[model samples]
Target: MIVSNVSFGCTKANSAWCVSSKDGHLEAAANRSLSPTGHLIVAVCLGFIGTLGFSNNLLVLALFCRFKVLRSPINLLLVNISVSDLLVCVVGTPFSFAASTQGRWLIGKTGCVWYGFINSCLGTVSLISLAVLSYERYCTMMGTTEADATNYKKIAMGILLSWGYSLLWTLPPLFGWSSYGPEGPGTTCSVNWYAKDANNISYIVCLFIFCLVIPFLVICYCYGKLLYAVKQVSGVNTGMGRTREQRVLLMVVTMVICFLLCWLPYGIVALLATFGKPGLITPEASIIPSLLAKTSTVVNPIIYIFMNKQFYRCFQTFVRCPNPSFTSSFRSTSKTTKPGQKSRKVETNNISIAVASMGRPSTFIQNRTNSNGEQGLSVKGSKPVVSLVAHYNG
Candidate 1:
């Protein structure tokens, strides 16, 4: 009969060899009892969905960077978000997938530490970045004059500070101050919450509150204000501009909804894992929650591409830039007109020029023709010419 050998912390029976035995027994039981098919399905589904999101985000960043016209302070934050999400998918999710499937740490101790550190760091940084984005959107939507160049600089600085915050939380695990490693047979690497050290518990709690909860609160607050401002603006405008304002509001609402759906489960799981009784949440159940946490990285790209027309247009332009045939097709479509056109139409293009002078001066020009075909100039800065009729007899 299989016996439960798990114990909390280092008891008298706990030693390197004993720990190895416990691990081996767990591995044997997992291998004998667990079906590979289910694990494979879960891994594939998570990986595919996560990769799709990451790829979309990367496409956004690539398109934005490729076109100079698309560059803006907001786009800069988006580029950072895309880069973070890409790293999460390319580095974090794969490690997670392997760990979840194998039910053990195939990698060594160092690999475990590095994986845990990077996973936490990237997750925290992504959350903080999202909060910053919401605030930036809030400023833009509210039409705050204070949201100028200096404020943009502050946003950039805030992004940098997020990285620092992430590093602060992740570095402790590397130094042996906190226990972070494989939690169970199927769990390849994570913080060892089962260890139940007071210091570890405190550290985890602090990290959770500051990194996750605080950032989420900030995001909600900023987006809330943004929605209110949008509503106020919508009440005043009843034309195309009102429609545009409503669209922006819808996009922000969608982002917040997606963020909540994707991250809430993970946050609950993290909290449970930190404080709840052991065995209350199994590793298998935690996999989905963890997958949901990672889903945010991929979701951002989808949101931007589908919600923003300008981004979509820029993406299309960037993708089609390599194909000469596509350009020819576009040109052909643009130049085509109706056949059998009758009369030539006169087209006048009115040009408005804004001239900046040291003292601020303005002038207007007008041309007029009298009944005798005499032209007159308006005093400001107008000039006219008279056409003379000549008759030649040969």
Candidate 2:
């Protein structure tokens, strides 16, 4: 009565295998495929975002590898995000662009499965990393013990757990909790939200709860606590401490804002399609949220890496002089200079001129010259001495 791989005709239109129809009978229907000319604008936009994401993540990785100043525990979490973004750019974005441009699944069924798996894996990894970063920031601000701020063990554990959680959630579809297939104009592949059966419904609910809802709640809670902590510090008369706290607050706000803007729409659309009728979200309308999610990979480096003063300095040094060794030499010479104007006046003057040319004061050190001609670079008494050698890889 019903069979797959059935021969209806000699042409390509009759080549599809039988699938379960809405009426519970096996029926043969031609796969719905789109044309290249239909979504040319969408294809171009995806291609542009893909290229930009690749470039931005590459720079983030380069900055992490090149500057020892950026190798802190918190920054390692950022690096984890960058790595995930890089994978998305290389493995998922290219295929997405290609498929969009061709207006069909050009790589066949195998490619579609791989595409869905990689995109799901890397996207989950990025979200988990964001949650970890938020928790780290919270602990730093609210911990009673001083050692909690510098705990390397916590950093290592966070990295492990973030990656493990992502793998745990994303690998289920491959193992058959649900399934991956083409979606939205027949070019892109993802978890089939339209599948309304028991197993598929359970998987979609769990995936949304664990990967999206839980992490979103955790991030919100941590940042909310952090905000309260900052507000409590306002009554204290420490101007410098308040400024530092405010800057950190701003960074965290940006991170959360970007994360919500990119993923929230996609999550809402998926949820609607999963619970409501499959016709709730049309293929053409789905393109906006998919493209929005992809743009997150590009926006991350701008907020996480480029906003930092240390990264800006390191990148500037790298562009002007490609040699890391030379950069180290410059750092060492600046640090070892004697605190007197008689022997180091020329050097001190040169340093001032350089800082002026850059149009920003050095954050690590300040120049102080006494009337008796004693000169040195130093920070405030409460601030720890940031040694150039300590931050240099070599």
Candidate 3:
């Protein structure tokens, strides 16, 4: 309408109307707000993505609640992650989607602050939860069995600390350590990256360091340790163990890649906007990374949980309702034979790994009969072999 007025109607319209139309045109261009079509596009994408994340994460929560056997400690951290993602879908995405369709923020200033705060707070919780999850996996693989029986206690503490650490950084912005406002095309809210004042800069720096940097570092270190442990275990000269080692390495790489893919670009753009000269990062460029960050809510559970064979089995069972028929049993299944020792296998589950009072023994032989009473054992002369099975049936 403004463009048409300037292009044709301005010549014949009243002088006042002509001037007002021109001002509106320039203002819209200067604000760099998305056009109506662009906003509708964002709304559609958010609607689909947000609904998927909401449903999947809600299902994950329900699975934990309905099934007592899946309520293991490590699984609790996963549940916490799903909870944070669910909150993001519920609280953060809906508001953004609504504002996008409206072509501007619908809520007032205080609402923007709360919007930014809740999203950032929950995002930080997810990040911290992933880090905590990685560190816990590292400790478990490193066989830190001293406190194995108290796994639940540690996980409960981890859940508390994740939220507490997230709040430690996010809450400061609400109380003037920094500030929250509309960000990324004026349809979403987050930290005021445009502000270059000392207060805002300091807070952004601290947030970058604590919320993003620290969690990433923790993840890398923990997964790196896991790789090293796998390398050591792979020395027993079995193709199965070597293959498992490679799979774990791939999982670690994928995990790290996902972490970077989701968060790193967002952090980079935030920094550039915060410290760069005016217009160094445009609204168009910044919104892509913002969308990627939002996408983590959907990507996380699919990558971290559903992809796991055991979890998928449980998920299938859970959804099947009346006659859930997946017979799931996880075996730690570490097979090893020392120099001259007979071949041995250690079969345990996540539960055994969690509650085993002693460290894992390298080579132990235990004859076992299957549920059908069929006996099987590795013969004495079998070549030295080792295998480590990592699954989640706790």
Candidate 4:
């Protein structure tokens, strides 16, 4: 049996997405729709998500650009993530918002394909960039030597690899390994998970394994080790060090959980459409995961602002005063050493307070004097990260 909502053609086999020929018959290419109330709700929600994501991420980028202190190599990876999310706000969400407001797929087939491809590309960039950022953080946490924080070349290479890797996975869909079509209430589009043919199923499987699984594993592995490593810090046995380590552990966990909570539902639902029988996911239910995934753009910057000492300080300073030189004054002193030098000690200052917040070891403890009258923190090996940490400690 079939039900009609005006021109919509709904069948029991795939009741969630009703076919509608009124919008130039393009929705017949596999788009679907929602009731008027549902469309209004989605439109309002998209407006909020899009506006907040765009504005917050824009502020983050502005803070980065305004402060030379925030230009460290590690922060570059963070900036890359913000860039990807910001692009999604500008390019991907608007079309869906328009479609939802108008109660149909407004841009037709070509627009649907573009929307799916661009969203996939940008989303993958954010995912892989997070993994890379975690790996870099691990390297920074493990030692102040190789993979040091000031290595611009390495950071640039990681940025390139993220975008290149995303293109590698997303472009194939354009060439017909799989395809793009509407999903969930027909106001948006993505890789056509509903198709049961070998081509579509195989593409979805490969995409699931390579694009989603591997990057998320990399993130979990890096951050998991970070949690363990934080506990093992030389200072963690001490009261202050232990407190700082616990804080770091909480931040690492928060980041991992946010990524999992945001994308996992969408991933699960997409797989259900790929493998389960049609209508296994209702259009209303399907939109929940989509909304959850989009919320990631909003969540990430919030985490950075509230949880990261460096980012928080920078953000605070940026808010209070927008001058670059004023921001640089907090971070301009060079704290590095020439290669082959033994551990040197420096007196703790306002600049050194960030070391404790950054989860540096007991050797790098801050805000108090060490055994020697002159020494506040002891660093064994000399690398560019010493300078970077000096800035980060700001």
Candidate 5:
């Protein structure tokens, strides 16, 4: 008979707690002493929240890319950030949640290796992307117009370096330089951070420095410079419309705040897990903290789309067609021909053509004469030019 395994280790070895011999070789049931209900609840909540953040960011990225007007360098980087976060949420979080729940890995050796590799790689990439964005904003606010050809090339190189850095941390396990295996209470997979091996400790330390500390320092420095630049430019109107520099400053501040909030815990935990003595903190506590660290991926998109007005407007335009009333009103206001000059149907068709070529010189209007027999001069003695420029660049 199959019996619960918990009783087998007792001094009086209860038979009811022991499985029958015919059931084959039995490993002891993993300890559930630390599997508190509250921990599970938190894990599930984080997983759901992370998933929502991931989905929102993905939607924003997709909308931005689909519209030509939204394709700026800043938005392009934001898309990269969102895609990284999406992978973390869509690919990483579920494994994390499962590890939290079962407290032991249900998936075996190969799954553990893959999950750990992806989790580390995505986390590294997200951190680097955040740093890149922070630096970009800092440069833009400082009026540093140096981001021309050389800067773009550098940015591209930086992206490649970030991936290479991530792979550097993630690939060693495949070669056995470091180990990734199931943690106690087998629901999650991670680097064997607490292993007694000196190589593991060295690898963990290197990962923390390259992946976390250095990036954090770069982001902090860039954002600090950005804040100083914003203050310096406080009085100067950049003439880019009513949206003040303060608004962009606020966005940057908000992004930095969220990044710190979401990531600080994970960084602390990793530091402690790597250098501190084992048994100081249980694996259960680390599980939630680890999940929290990865939540930044999903959170980045929400911050950009919801907090920035320009991004929101571009997002709306990209996702939905222009309002019918607005389109019609625009056509009427820009129409070139007199309303009574032609049949209603012909007038309508002409209006469409006029709207289509609103700013360009066209053959249809080349021979048209003004009341003074000049080439359609306005009262100011200039051509009655029609200008229609749509400004949707984010």
Candidate 6:
């Protein structure tokens, strides 16, 4: 049914506005409504999902800020991810939700640009951070604990570069390489795929490849190598089951899988929209991909913090009223590696403790001490070894 506004014609199909004449004011009437039933349902659902994401990311920020131990090099990358996702929750979700309900772009052109830029930046940040996290973990699996701990400078550089990279792709829209305007359901803003021309189409293709495809490939390569190393380590020490290490690895693997599942469909849909024939997907149908993409922000906290036993314990301790034991528990301790023990160094100190809590071998430099009090950097049994052997530099 057509909805009558004082100055314009509105349709339920796309919530599009068309005036009877060009001189008619572009401003939609403040009291005008469109597709009330459909918009209301979409609005409620987006609001709920956005709230869950915002709250989860908020908790992550609070936990990282509250705990001193979490300030380690690897966790700083996590903090970066949380900050990016939190900004998206604060700036992008609400605007998109409201616009979805209103059935059109209510925030005007300037708001649309800001919304698209910020959301695009945060999305890129989230993607790059995940890849960096995976690479860092992979390095930890292959490097000494001391080497991993000392690479704080490198980690910081990586975080900064990620933000820069995000801007590199997102800012071009403002420069005429492409443009940002209303997208799916006309309630959200993204790269204007509708502007299908040589320049805009090229930008879209490059953005997708650089932002999504490359990062995905890097993450897969890192995880694959890390898992292979884990398998080799397991086979070498059949007498001692690395139950704890295996469990931690399992959780880490699950997190990467979740990240892919949450985002891959959205990326696929976006690519299809950009490269495929016109009218390939209805605006209403686009909501599914948008919702799936937002879900990544919510699931991140569960993977990065809540599922981690150490972070949970630290959070519990932080929440308690000040006490002598609580203060003591918060204090950092330095442990020297003893001669002749097997240790697996994790990329981050938090990962070390997380694995320790899981009753597995930790990311410590494990050296074997022989009967004559001589220490040898070697695997205990005759099982085949892998690149992890090169990490024993002590």
Predicted model with the maximum TM-score? 4
Q: Over the full model, what C-alpha lDDT does candidate 4 score relative to the true structure? A: 0.68
User: Model 5: per-residue lDDT, tens digit, 1-394?
Assistant: 0112222333132111222333221334344223558447746776786678677877877777665434444556667777777887787677657655654344545776687778778877878877876666555434343223113455566577667777887889778776665433335556765454577668777877877778888888876775554443332223321233456566667877787777777767666755666444464666566656666665777776556544565565556787987545434432433222211111221221111111111113223466786542112111111111111222
User: How badly does each model clash, as a count of residue pairs?
Assistant: 3, 0, 1, 1, 9, 8
How do these models rank on TM-score, best leading? 4, 3, 6, 2, 1, 5
Candidate 2 on 312-361: residue-level lDDT in tens?
66778867865778677557633443222110111343332111001011
Superior candidate under lDDT, 4 versus 6: 4
Better of 1 and 2 by lDDT: 2
Task: Give lDDT tens digits, candidate 6, residues 255-308.
Answer: 768877877877777777766665565555566777778888888878877776
RMSD of each: 14.7, 10.0, 9.8, 7.5, 13.6, 8.0
In order of appearance, the predictions have TM-scores of 0.70, 0.75, 0.77, 0.78, 0.68, 0.75
Model 1 misplaced regions, further than 4 Å: 1-34, 100-103, 143-152, 183-188, 321-394
Q: Model 4: per-residue lDDT, tens digit, 306-355?
A: 46556666778767864777545445431332222222233344342223
Question: What stretches of model 3 exceed 4 Å from their correct place?
Answer: 1-30, 146-150, 321-325, 328-394
TM-score winner, 2 or 4? 4
Q: Residue 139: error of model 4 in Å?
A: 2.0
**Residue 392 miss distance in model 2 (angstroms):** 38
| lDDT for each candidate structure | 0.56, 0.64, 0.68, 0.68, 0.54, 0.64
Q: Which stretches of candidate 6 lie over 4 Å from their true place?
A: 1-35, 144-151, 238-242, 245-249, 319-394
